[model samples]
Target chain A: EADIYQTPRYLVIGTGKKITLECSQTMGHDKMYWYQQDPGMELHLIHYSYGVNSTEKGDLSSESTVSRIRTEHFPLTLESARPSHTSQYLCASSGTYNEQFFGPGTRLTVL
Target chain B: GESVGLHLPTLSVQEGDNSIINCAYSNSASDYFIWYKQESGKGPQFIIDIRSNMDKRQGQRVTVLLNKTVKHLSLQIAATQPGDSAVYFCAESRGFQKLVFGTGTRLLVSP
Candidate 1:
């Protein structure tokens, strides 16, 4: 089945540690996005990629960076994690203006 | 600075009852809108979508109503069930694939 996937569903790392969240989509979508969401709060876009080798920062300034090496893969990396960085990270992909499909999400906890 | 917001932060409804969630956007230029249902510890799932040219659209036991004049949107769930309990959010897209999401309304269904 064609779907989006995220690895490390839950992560607990110490502060200052480097961590990467992996996201992959099998639907061959060119547009991918990363969103940060606090528990029970609204999702805030952190990064997005329009196509291969393209990335942009979203409305909410983020300390993380993302890369799109392939159409199906978009990974986010935090050079130095902090406790404030602890939140759920969701990945999504879309083909056009239609609905977007989201990954299961990665819950990160920086202790 | 077009922001999307929800009318209610949370809603509680009995099982088998109808549930309604409302959203409002500040951008009239938005061309598309979507409703997403997100359960705890998971990502948002696409529920329904509506274009600016349309007023209403329906899906399995769900309906989405869009009003461009007032920049308002609504999602109605028929015969609400426990599985339907989640956070519902409305997203708006203008030209780019970037979707701006609303604050979200938590739906709690009681048996």
Candidate 2:
């Protein structure tokens, strides 16, 4: 099994609430990424990090922000969540050009 | 932004049969391609990958075929089983960096 993990597998919160989704991996991978996806839709990369203190936005526009202070931890936070942000968030990690290992994912629902 | 598959195409196959799922990508600079499998309410897990220099690679009962000439990729699963039911995705990478993922195909293996 993959070592990657995501917290709050399912979440339902009211509008304008603050939320943080946690992602961590014990594989010691340098590349970490966060993607947002809806049911039966294409995944959109939202954020990625090369290493600690390095984070970049992906091709898609996102309201969530991420921090990579530790190699094993990359967390995403939405200061003010909205209904538009409802989707499944996936965390992935990779080494070199090897395949990416994904977490179980966090399903977020905004009301 | 590059376009991944928008709709999730589905394939139903009988147990013990072989299944093939195809994907077409637009990026010509993509040098690496990978296949991922995702179960319901979970993140995508890597299945196999092939570099642009190679046309095919095998992993256990799974095979990945990359056709750079047509910018198309395909995945074949031999001896399909009910446990193989899940969504499969194709991802392309340029220069071994950022990845562009296809919308994905759902496979259902009947017993």
Candidate 3:
């Protein structure tokens, strides 16, 4: 099994509340990624990091921000969560080969 | 603006039969491809992957076929079981960049 893990598998909050989704991996992978997926839809890359202090925006524009202070941790934070952000947030880590191993995912619901 | 997509939204198969899921990618530059299986309320699990240099790769009871000429990818599962019911996604990446995921195909296996 993959060593990637995500906290708070489910979250529900009101609009405008700030929230942080935690992601961590024990595989010592340098590349970490965050993806947003809706029900019955494909995953869209929102953010990614290539080792410590190296972060980049993904193909999809997202309001959340990510920080990669440590090689194993890549957390995503939403300054002001909106109803539109109600979806599944998946965290993944990959090695040099680019085959990603995903976490269990955090399902967010902005009421 | 390139994208990956699936020809079928859903596929129904009988138990003990073979199942195939197809995907098409618009970017011919993609060099690596992977297949993921996502069960309900869980993260996507890495199933198998095939590099552009290879036309076919097999793992356990799963096989991945890549056809660069038509920009097509496929996953074949032998002896489909009820436990194999899930959403199957195909992802493509060029080099070490972020992956582009195709709209998943839901596999329904019935006894």
Candidate 4:
């Protein structure tokens, strides 16, 4: 399987609560990405990083933010959770010209 | 804007039958493409990949065909099995940068 991992495979939280979704890869890939997917819909790229200290917003507008302080870690945070934020968050890492390896994903439910 | 899309939203196949899923892209600049399989409540899994230079690539049971002239891609599964049921996505990327994912195709392999 892929070396990528995400914490809290499922999460349920009340509105206005702060939450962080964790993602890490042991492959030491320079490229990492975070995608949001709703049921029966396509995956949306929310945030991506080329390397440490390098992060960029994806095509979709998202309230969630991400940080890449370490090469193997990319964490997505929400200032305050909302009901609209309920969805599955996927983490992926890739090497040059190769396919991405994805984590198990975190299913978030904001109450 | 560049984006990827699937021709159909859902595809149902019988066991032992061959299956084909088609995808289209708006960006000719994208030279790399990858196919992913995602089951319910799980993250997407890498299936196959094809670069612009190649027209076809094959894995164990899956084959990806790329038609650069038409900016179209297709995934063919030989002798599809029930375990092959999942949502399939085709993604495109230019120069190993951020990828644009296509609308997903839910594959139902009935036994």
Instruction: Point to the candidate with the largest TM-score.
Output: 1
Rank the models by lDDT, top first. Answer: 3, 1, 2, 4
Measured with C-alpha atoms, the lDDT of residue B39 in candidate 2 is 87
How far out, in Å, is residue A44 in model 3? Answer: 0.8
Quote the lDDT for A15 in model 1: 92
Winner by DockQ between candidate 3 and candidate 1 = 3
**Model 3 spans > 4 angstroms off:** B1-8
Give lDDT tens digits, candidate 4, residues B11-94.
999999999999998799998999999998899988888889999999998899999889999999999999999999999989
lDDT of residue A62 for candidate 2 = 91
After superposition, the stretches of candidate 1 with alpha carbons farther than 4 Å from their true spots are B1-8
Off by over 4 Å in 2: B1-5
- Residue-level lDDT tens digits of model 3 in A1-111: 449999989999999999999999999999999998887677888999989999999988988999999999999999999888898999999998888999999999999
Which window of 10 residues has the lowest lDDT sum in candidate 4 chain A? Answer: A93-102
Q: Which candidate should be chosen as best, given lDDT against the real structure?
A: 3
* Candidate 4 Cα errors over 4 Å, as ranges: B1-8
lDDT of 2 by residue, B49-84 (tens): 899999999999999998888999999999999999
Error of 1 at A16 (Å): 1.2
lDDT of 4 by residue, A5-54 (tens): 99989999999999999999999899999998877677888999999999
Q: Report, for all candidates in order, the number of backbone clashes.
A: 0, 1, 0, 0
